[model samples]
Target chain A: MSTPVLELARVTVEFPTDRGRLRPVDGVSFSVEAGKTLAVVGESGCGKSVTALAIMGLLPQGGEVGGGIRLAGEELLALTPDQRRARRGGEMAMVFQEPMTSLNPAFTAGEQVAEALRLHQGLSPDAAFAKAIEMFRRVRIPEPERRARSYPHQLSGGMRQRVMIAMALACRPRLLIADEPTTALDVTVQAQILALIDEMKRETGTAVVLITHDLGVVRDHADEVVVMYAGRIAERAKAADLFANPQHPYTIGLLGAVPRLEGGAARLASIEGTVPDLMNPPPGCRFAPRCPFAIAQCAEQPPLAEVTPGHQAACWRAPLDTLLEQAA
Target chain B: MSAPLLELRDVAKGFPVRDALGRRRGAVRAVDGVSLIVPKGSVLAIVGESGCGKSTLGRLALRLIEADQGQILFEGEDLRGLSARALRARRRDMQLIFQDPFASLDPRMTVEQAVAEPLRLHGIVPRAQEAQRVAELLSRVGLRPELARRWPHEFSGGQRQRIAIARALASEPKLIIGDEPVSALDVSVQAQVVNLLQDLIRELGLTFVLISHDLGVVRHIADRVAVMYLGRIVEEGPTAQVFGAPRHPYTRALLAAVPGQGHAHAPLLEGDIPSPINPPSGCRFRTRCPYAQPLCAEQVPPMEGTSHLAACHFQQNLPPALVGQDAETGGERLRRLQAYFTDQTQKQGELA
Candidate 1:
């Protein structure tokens, strides 16, 4: 589809733990087209955020990136450290869950936005300042002139998040990676932020990689869904298709566990097991330990195969048609 | 037909808020003019955003913090008259389960010690019986009884929460008030905990007061739901009615806000929530109210109805046929709202 804006072709992110080099993101491959949102949903420690960090080239020390990372037909892995730094804000940006930490307390929100622009674009001092104010306006910050001088401590949680978004969008990056952007926000504020992000994507046509643990957020805003479990893509499909028919046992368990809005006062279908540790995941299928319908074949790692035209699920016993039927 | 288990009549609580100068300039009206009843063996969920005072209302109901005004009656007993010792006795019947399991537990104490502390405090059982009671409590919450010797740190988030539940049940409380019990937990973990609570409710016939922001959780556990705004209940009803067909504009807006509801987003509630210390002149929601008329601005909507309640100037079910209309508009309006917001911001940005 016109060369995906971003692609992780069999990417693997590894870390040096006490035991040895452990792969947190194992042989994962996915892509996002410009103007579309690809949601990665999973429980904690499912390598959701780690995958996002890996894309942004912001991995901490002692961690290594293995495999392909392409951005708009260009190999990001081949880029020099300076080239990667230059590419970051001007072409790609991120907004973390907690804005309080993501933002610099020493600087005003406007300064932070201006700094992002100045570093990547080399804008003049006056021009950078002006752009910062303009970016704040784009994020719907009330009284941009006044807020430009106010420190991070002065803003509310919602406003602080707006500033973070402004910083991420200042240079109009081709890709915006939001990691649990609204996790700390209230429901109403969350609605506003999601609406804002959706609007920005349509206007800028910037591809978005949304990483979150909330299924509702995925349902509301995402164009495509990539369900991950223990460092691998367990299921991948269009958002509409995934909701209509989740073929993976993990996906089914996640949907059933949540209290549905439309259903009659039915019992919540809870998944039975805990999320596995990525450091020492199961030998075969990482999810087989938790799968209710795990068969003898599950002991052999099942490759993520297309269960439908565009829907892929990595499960040995999940009847593709049955899950689709129940969802309908 | 019997009297409700717990009732709060015109309850209010105000906490002194200090200004930047360290002077107590005003009091934040956390919970104001709230009234509701919890039926015997039924669950009542109080739902709202932060600063709506739902959590404070819960704590106030238990007299963990005394209400500045209004009456809290527990099965016809006035909470105000109870002596410290008598209140301690009543604590055995009404227990609170906090939202953060890690924060609530003692890191040094083993699970066995934590569970047994309540038993020792209430003097519910003798020394020998304490061990047996601890094991039973552990098993009741779906934990292996032998793992009680492990410290809270050894358990996962879900397991720690289960331990907390086991400790709460040590007193065999007739009423359990869970304050955002599962908000901090994993969704799968949340489901298991919710299921365990439901099972406990059915088996013990214990009344419950659940305070949560997640509407789905409320819908699952609550027999009745109360919608709160700026410390007051704007709507109350049976779970099905409240969810299936919310009457108030606010309730309708909330139902629309939930993703996957297939509702058109209407400019995602404008402006930040106003300070509770200075609520709007009339309706607290009127500041951000889309349908606010001159009447809404001048007068406070009466919180009305018996079996089901809604506070609004024009509130006769909003032309009943209009129900489920939101489900039809779905993503189109959401897309439009997103575009509008983005464009509007762009203009605002250009202006600056």
Candidate 2:
């Protein structure tokens, strides 16, 4: 079998606080092949963003990372800071949630994208600027030549995101990590930006790690999904199988929580209680406290095990059908 | 039907735009000549993207911001004509819930104090019974009474929003306007809040005006929906009718833009929402409307239809909304999986 474009093996990220350590991302493992999209789904503080940051070697100050992050069989943690920086824009690129914040307000949109090209590909100043305009055109920004001169604040939210995408893909990196790329924009503009990313992925065969809290976006865009709860992987499977036969209790509760546009029950199914604080996580399964099907055996953490052929869940009573049948 | 609990007739509001040097450039017409009626004990959701005036309309309805033009009638009385003192008295009947719970709440105040402030202001309860009243209010929104002593900063996002809701309900309001109340919450917590709001609306027979951009939430909670673009409402109708058979091209495009509604490749709208400072000549949506014709630019289209209305010249001849197959979400198995969730909740209820 061909090697995957990117693979994470039991990644852990911790930050030392005055009150002991806080592990935001704990033992997360997943992979994405060339041209496939892997969606990391979670709520606020679930460490989905931290995982992305860890992979990019962009963790905030005081953060300590452990475990393997491989890009095309190249071990990333073993690389020096300068070597990592060299490979960042050339081999892997990340697009942030808010373009207004991520982009430099002082630079014109065109210059911002062109700077990446010159730094990564060693293109001439004039050639890089010309290619930046071409990249803008490829992303379907209208009147690319004129619009390129506009600063970040001068462009609309959708247009600013287009510029960000153009910059991220200008290097044609093997891996693209977009952290909630469209959450700040309106839904209509979100559609346009998502389509642009999908199109670019197909054209470049870039492996995508899309981190979002919106299930609808995942349902439509993701090839595979990793459902995270309290910094731990709760479930992982092909998107179709995950949606159809969600094994973990958290995944089921999350799927039932989203208000379906197609219309369903009047009242949404809610999982009781808030997400557990990760500062002092539970001794056993991270989701046990909130899991309705939790048993005494759940006091010992369950390893991520196969529930079906390619589907894995970290619940003691996974293959919940058997659990339910036993209960009945 | 009886008279509407709240009504707006040709309401319009504009904010003056200023350049960096502070010179008056032009006014951004936020809400332009919008008219609607909210019947007693019903949910009317105004859905649109940012800059679409849904939030501005909600503020106008509550008199939080004054409209430059038009009449706002509350229970057959015009609010625009009310005196300052009279408006304060009327304020007890209406309340506003903002989108961000963290920003909306006061960190310094305890939950009990925040919830009881409205009661004290409105003279709903005597000073002696204020604590008891606050406790009851907290429990009504599904918060524990003991948590009342805790500060707002101590609560989670969802908990803070419940405290906000409890405060909103303290004065026993008849009409509530929630501007993207659940938008900032996580999916699971959002569901909990949505269900809580649903129960509150039903049990209290409250009239609700939900201003949100989330179509799925609107479809679940609203009896009727209004789709806005630029500064004007482009479509208004029963939620089922509008979602099932949208007439306006803009509304169709908005529905199609939902993530799971159609294939990702088939994008509907093109350019961003045009600047509200100098909107299009006639129809505000014409710039992005796929089926826009010369007539659309020539004259503004008046809203047509009795119960269901669409403000478009070609609304009648527009093609049906092409939302993709319902089976893409893995329909049958998903339903079966969700059924187990419902069963588990019921079992929990029984055990309790």
Candidate 3:
């Protein structure tokens, strides 16, 4: 089997606060195999975005790495700032949530894309322009040549996203990290964008780390699913198995909460309580406060245990297959 | 029922477009030849993509923007018959909830002031009783009455929307038009707001005309659904019929693209929504319609229906999707969505 493209082993991101070194991500581990996809899904401030930002080495100021962040066999944590800068857009690239702000206003769509190629590959200006235009074609940007000179404002919301994808793919990174990429896009455009990424991954065999709160999007795009709550992995499994049988209460709650388009009478089962304050995380399973199936043992931090091969859930009732079946 | 509290008869709106040569070019038809019957105390959702005349039709219904052609009837009275002052007086019964809560709310005004402003302006209640009325409205929409004292900046996106809703409810209107109300909110938050709106519809017995880009929200809130394409309603039917078993190809495509719509796709359209200024001949959706035939391009498809309506000529020819029958399979359908998306992904690769 091919080596994993990106791996986070016991990765935790910490910050120095007035109280103490508050850990935002605590001992979380996940990997993205080549040509595969892993989704980190949870509500806001659940450490989904933080985990992605940590992987990208784009953590906001005052953040410190407390564990291993490896990309293509290299220890990213050990790399200097300049070296990491070299790593970004060369081996690993990030596609952000908001394309409007991520893209520059002054630059034409082509110029912005070509800038990536030129900066990374040191291609001649003409060569870079040609390559950027080709990338645009690959992403299915209409009238690639004509759209090349157009500014971000000139293109529609979906078209702007295509441009962002073009820029991300321009470098042909080994690992692509998309943080809520389609959250802002309309449904049709989201389908197209997801398809674009899926196509790119198949063609290039690039490993992708998708971070989003949307369960359906994760189901649609991911090969593996990582359910994150309160800066910890609640459950991790293949997308099919995860959806077929969600183990964690948080995962179950999330699945049950989503309103289906078919219009059922089933009441959305909201997981009780908001995500705990990251400033002072709970001692036990962070989801214990919200978990209906939580036990006294869960008051002590539950270890991420393998309930099944290729599937792990950090729950005392991890093997509640029968209960899950009943709930579904 | 209730004589269709609000109605639009042959309503259309167009704005003058100027060319580079500084001459007045052809008018941009924003909403064209649209008609709707918004029954009292029920929710009617207008679902469509951008430039689909949904918003314009929504505005035309309330006369927020005047229709260049056709009639707007409020409780069997023609809106145009009334003088400006009389129209303003009638407007107390119809209020609009805009798409963006951030932009809709007055920045300078406190939530209390914003909500009570309507009460004061319309003199719905005694001037001294405005504060109590505002608080009651706030709490009704699931907001804390004390929140009224704070500014919009102090609240989250959902909270701001609640304040907006509170303000909309201030007039005690019979019919409320929510233009993409929950499209801007988070899923969990959206569900809360959607539920709140549903509760409002039931409790207040206020008629709702919802214009939204999110069909899921429509599926939940609307009694009847209207699907628009290029300034025209391509399909309109009972929410169940339109969503469970969508007839039109365009409607099917829209459903297929919806996140949990049981049917997923490789996005049937290759290009953007066409310029309404130069809409395609025949079926407006023909340019991007996946199942468009030569006949579709030759002659315009009339918006036809027996009891419910659709404008697609090949409605019967298209493959069946759950339009009205979807409610029974809601959970099962979402569970199966992963398979559908994977299938589309495969098709995309194969097509590519």
Which candidate comes out best when scored by TM-score? 2
Better of 2 and 3 by lDDT: 2
State which docking tier applies to candidate 3.
acceptable
Candidate 3 structure quality by residue, lDDT tens digits, A1-328? 7678998999999989898887878889998999999999887767888888888889999999878989988999999999999988878888998899999999999999999899999999999999999999999998999999999988988899889888988899999999988888767778878888988999998899988888777777789999888888999999878877667777766775566677764345444334677887777888876566667888799899999999999987768655446666
Candidate 2's TM-score reads 0.97
TM-score, chain B, predicted structure 3 = 0.88
Q: How accurate is candidate 3 locally (lDDT)?
A: 0.81
For candidate 3 chain B, which ten residues in a row score worst on lDDT? B343-352
Per-residue lDDT of candidate 3, residues B27-141 (tens digit): 8899989888888878888888877888888888888788898999999999977899999999899999987899998889999999999898898999888888988888888
On lDDT, the candidate that comes out on top is: 2
Q: What is the C-alpha lDDT profile of model 1 across A1-328, one tens digit per residue?
A: 3999999988889999898778889988999999999999998888889888888889988778888999998999898888998889889999999999988899887888888888888998779989999988887888998998999998989999998888888888999999999989888888889888998888899999999888888888899999998899999999888877667777877776777665443456566667777777778899877665567888799998988898888887655444334534
Ranking by DockQ: 2, 1, 3
> For residues A21-84, could you state the per-residue lDDT of candidate 2 as single tens digits?
9999999999999999999999999999999999999999989989999999999999999999
Whole-model lDDT, candidate 1?
A: 0.83
Highest DockQ: which candidate?
Answer: 2
Q: Name the lDDT value of residue B129 in candidate 1.
A: 87
Of the true interface contacts, what fraction does each candidate have?
A: 0.37, 0.57, 0.18
Off by over 4 Å in 1: A263-265, A322-328, B263-267, B317-352
For all candidates in order, the CA lDDT equals 0.83, 0.89, 0.81
What is the per-residue lDDT of model 1 for residues B1-352, given as tens digits with 9 covering 90 to 100? 5688898899999999998899998999999988889988999999988889999998998899999999889987888779989988898889999999999999999999999999999899999888888988888888888898889988888888889988999998988999999998888788878878888889999999999998888888889999998888999999888888787877777766776544354337766778887888778888787778788888999977778889988787355512322122123322222232233323433111
